[model samples]
Target: MSKISTLQVEKVNTHIVNWLITYAENAKVNGFVVGISGGVDSAVTSTLCAQTGLSTLCVEMPIHQAPSHVSRGREHIEQLKKRFPNVTNVEADLTTIFDGFKTIVPIVSDSDKVNLSLANTRARLRMATLYYFAGIHGLLVAGTGNKVEDFGVGFYTKYGDGGVDLSPIADLMKSDVYALGKYLQIPNSILEASPTDGLFGDDRTDEDQLGASYDELEWAMLEEEKGKISENFSGREKTVFDIYKKLNTINQHKMNEIPVCIVSNDIK
Candidate 1:
């Protein structure tokens, strides 16, 4: 059962398509360039971009990505191409680049730290790849982050997946994204697959990393918005609420703007 309410699928779809088209026209860009991760967010975002009748480039930057993720991503892209003439795709197998980066970086004693850092590195590498295509093609990099990940828990890596010219679905919850994905007629392979960032080069899911399900997190976010505290809950609800609060607190760095030092006039 989803904690988020059902969306008006057709109206939401039309609104997002129009928004993407308007943003692109104002920015004077050719279209949107989305990183397809074989997840619901990317599927919906790329589909929305495609509906604008603008050139939507779905770039697959796989850095030791799992086989399932790759296949699902390709499936969605192929379906998109067949459905929309404005859609195109390119796969940049970044496994070699990622390995080369590890060889050059200094060896660290902490295996855990190194593993996490490398995972984020994979995302940063993909970000650079997306910008590369965006630069040459005059397209804006469309972010695939949803509301629960982007605002609720800040699950994205800083300046990695977090870096984007515009976000088409950041305002929608994970369930909302799934709803949009269904209405967009995305591949069942993607619609049914467990949500994973595919940054860690393994099958560990987003729930495994977050220690909570998207539905639980969504409920926690709503409670927090209502000024509820952990003291008000008990059992698993309290545990999940605490998890959400802790992540929301720690990831404020990613959610907020980069801090700038304001030089006082007297200092000069």
Candidate 2:
């Protein structure tokens, strides 16, 4: 059972849609731009943006994307267009762009390092693509990140997925996002689909990379937030908490704002 209620879900949906509309209007921009990755977060976010009746651009920037994932994204956009006239779906295939980047870049032997670097590059490339459209048209890049990924473990790449003018769902947990997705009537295929970064060339789910399910992570986050870490926690809980802490510590850089060095005026 969900910890959140139906009314809470509706409230969040209304709040997000209103915020998107107000933010875009106050900024005097044409609209909001989002990159659709066929994940629940993106689907829900883009849908909410479309509900605002703004000229929302949903771009699918696939870099060696899985065909199933691509189809899911395209289908979601098609459905959105049928419902929302302000929605526009565009495809920016970045496979060749990525290949061109890899050609001139220095090579590394460490498999993990190489993969991590390439994944981040894919995210930044997608960021650039969103901004490219946002720049040409006066629009702000809307981020598709949830609370757990955005603040708990900093799962997003800095200045990549994290680089955005606005994040409508940053306050929502993964489960909350799911609830909102259902409330927003996002496609069932996307809600049932395992969330992925789509940065890896292969079919690795987010849980495969994170070492624990979103449920486990969310539980750990709740416990940590409540300052309720206890010795009586089950083995599974302990393990999840340990992993969560390690990730949080390692990725704090991504969550925190950039530090500036203030020059002292006093002469030494």
Candidate 3:
């Protein structure tokens, strides 16, 4: 086991909580907003927000693709209520909303493409709901991405799950994240869940699809930057290698700022 600094970790969490409250205050909102997906990242964020003495609202926005996530989401919300008695449990069904919108949004006939599109559409629709509620209730949306994910293969959807007024866990790595959860007393159920986007079925986990565990990928990323490379790795190394290559290839648009048409130094 690595010699992780518990005190330093505690300080970081404290800073994060303080920052979140300040962000909500600056946004002219009474508290923070969040989406709990029966996953650790959101669970931690929601708990921290509620403990910050802010009026936190945790919205469970699972779609039809994965009802398991909905069950888990309810479990998490109930757990959050026990841990942070101040957070509101807002259950919203995004399935009908997405279904209604799908008609106007033309999609390719490809089944795989359609599934991917639906997965992403659900995320964006949920975010829209969060923002709408945040606006009406005077709250700021809290993002739940972590360092391991932020550095590894792009996991979050742009403008969809990625839309947030503040992110509390953007610096903590995955291994370190579990420890924080323990310290915060987050329920075992959420902490133990195989991390996922819940964009599809129950089996659609992040590690399986991303082709690598968060630990290995994060290590590779940090080492590569320091001109140090680990040649010896398990079979999983190949998975990480392939995923890193694939993300670089397919998610290239994420590497650039939003599309800006470069033209002859001429303004229209």
Candidate 4:
């Protein structure tokens, strides 16, 4: 697509800020509770919420989190507080909670299965923590997921990071989030930092796990959405398209509501 202009970015910023304020007001909520993961997506989403002039509680939920990653998240909150007075910070370390689960459960030797299960558990723990704060304060849990991850590939864990009361950046592409981050003048350290889920202990980035760049995946997603995949087949283009399709098929469940077994009244 075309390069996003400064005016367009500003407009988006204003739109999201206004939307957050209006959404909260309509819901009769006090403020927004967002999990600040020190990633660009969270940085931008929290910044938008802060700009709304509403009370924004930026929670840092660390479960076996790296010191550097935790520092980045705290730094972003500190920087945001300087500009936005309504911003607040809270750190909830869930490492103990996670370790408790491991201690009780039988150790599984399957590396991939065990790692993924723990990563997802971390996400769910953070989700629970965010809601806990939101519940006590009567606030909404603002999600940090962007379009490419939430919709294009469903990269978020189901009922984990994907569980939220509101998603301010869900419609924004990853590139667009970067543009907004720059527009809002987010902390440069966060901007320069690699986007990782911080779920894995290995420091593997989202792209590393996805096996493709956000730009490539986004392009393929856009093409897939337009239903033009069958138009032509080439080398790299075809490869990207195939990868996008595979991700969609694998993650389609996440994009939809939870499935339930339906029963007939007569049968009951």
Q: Best lDDT goes to which candidate?
A: 1
Model 3's TM-score against the true structure: 0.86
Instruction: Give residue 225's lDDT in candidate 1 (0 to 100).
Output: 96
lDDT of 4 by residue, 1-268 (tens): 3334233798898898899999999999889999988899999999999998989999998887888888889889999999989999888989899999889977678988988998999999899999999999999999999998988888999999999998999988888998889999988988898889989977788879987778878888888887777447588778777877888889999998789999999999
Model 1 regions lying over 4 Å from their true place:
none
Most accurate candidate by TM-score? 1
The TM-score measured for candidate 1 stands at 0.98
Candidate with more favorable, higher TM-score: 2 or 4: 2
lDDT of each: 0.92, 0.88, 0.75, 0.88
- Output the TM-score of candidate 2: 0.96
Model 4 is weakest, by summed lDDT over 10 consecutive residues, at 1-10
Predicted candidate 3 versus true structure: per-residue lDDT over 56-161, tens digit per residue: 8999876774665667778877877776767887778877787788788878879889888878888888889999989998888888888756545567788887
Model 2, 1-268: lDDT tens digits are 1245233987778888898889888999988899999899889889999999999999999899999898899889999999999999888999999999999999988989989999999999999899999999899999999999998878899888999999999999898889888888889999999988888889999889998888788877888898866464768778888888888889998988789988788952
lDDT of 1 by residue, 97-156 (tens): 999999999978999999999999999999999999999999999999999899999999
Give the poorly placed runs of model 2, Cα more than 4 Å off.
Answer: 1-7, 230-232
lDDT, model 4: 0.88
List per-candidate RMSD values in Å: 0.9, 1.7, 3.0, 1.9
| N/CA/C clash count, model 2 | 0
Off by over 4 Å in 4: 1-7
